[model samples]
Target: MPVVKEAPLLDGSAGRLVRLYTVSGGRTRPTASLDLLTLVVATGSEPPPRSGPEHAQAMGLCRGPISVAEIAAHLGVPVTVAKIVLSDLVDCGAVAARPPDSFDHPTDRSLLEAVLDGLRRQL
Candidate 1:
């Protein structure tokens, strides 16, 4: 007969989490870690949101990796508006992009080079 022992537990304001470590082959490994991402949830009233034609169009354009300002110009909206829409999409997980860098419109040579490179890759 063998005795069964329980794992140690960690408690939080939201829930209790169990921490378990396993020993094997002279090595110790943590079997589990706290689900910190999903365990703490947000609860509060949110603002009423709106989307214009350009915003909807931008959402589609942003389905693939894209820069925020590029999508803004493509959809004919001001950069500020585009930024808000992009932020909302990111928070909602509808689109994905690197967070904006201090933006400058891509230069002519830069644009042409990127296009050529893309064409080369496809061929």
Candidate 2:
């Protein structure tokens, strides 16, 4: 009888590295306009056929509105990778992306002082 040797399994970090690479398909840039604070929500439609697990996972997380950073944290991938996966979903209409609202003017000092005063009063 011939003895067979099984291939060594990847360690946790190595496995995650491979998963990230595979999830992003070795792409480093996202085609969509996505920032850390950009919010994403599922469109209540099924993912396109042959979509990767990352896409499905992203859609699941986006069942409620979620930030790109939050999706990255939940998927255990870098923000860039999360953006790529999200872009794919967006292209297929599985998710919708919304840019965060930006303040047009600098924060008011009075507002800052009021918040500080409120915190002090609470304490």
Candidate 3:
């Protein structure tokens, strides 16, 4: 297993900022269109030779489909940072991304009720 570097907190600290910058290769924006709800999965392709540790770690987490928000949480990095890393993997064909399903009627009462019922059942 490749060693993944610990993600630094985005606490407005200089050292943390530097590490984050390093992780993203100084790129502030991702080329791929991604959101918190976007689902990413491993494509079973190896990362490029020059890929960073974050790429490897992200790939490991992506053995199954996982949301971008979950990836950020697991990686201990900010959502933006996760997006950057995921975008790179996407560009390299090492990972595949699925946009979140769109709901035609987001305000449907039945949907809300179903969600509430599911939550209640969990509790």
Descending-TM-score candidate ranking: 3, 2, 1
RMSD of each: 20.4, 6.6, 5.8
**Predicted structure with the largest TM-score when compared to the true one:** 3
Task: Write model 1 residue lDDT over 11-36, tens digit each, in one string.
Answer: 45734242111111122321222111
Model 1: residues with Cα > 4 Å off, grouped in runs? 1-51, 99-123
> How would you encode candidate 2's per-residue C-alpha lDDT over 38-119 as one tens digit per residue?
8999998888878876787788899898999999998878999999999988888889998766534557899999999999
Q: Which stretches of candidate 3 lie over 4 Å from their true place?
A: 1-18, 102-123
Each model's C-alpha lDDT? 0.45, 0.85, 0.87
2 or 3, greater by TM-score: 3
- Which candidate number would show the highest lDDT if scored against the true structure? 3
Clashing pairs in 3: none
Model 1 Cα displacement at 89 (Å)?
0.9
Tens digit per residue, CA lDDT, model 3, 1-123: 999876654456554544878889999999899999899999988889888777778999999999999999988789999999999999989999987665333577888899999999999
Q: Against the true structure, what is each candidate's TM-score?
A: 0.37, 0.71, 0.72
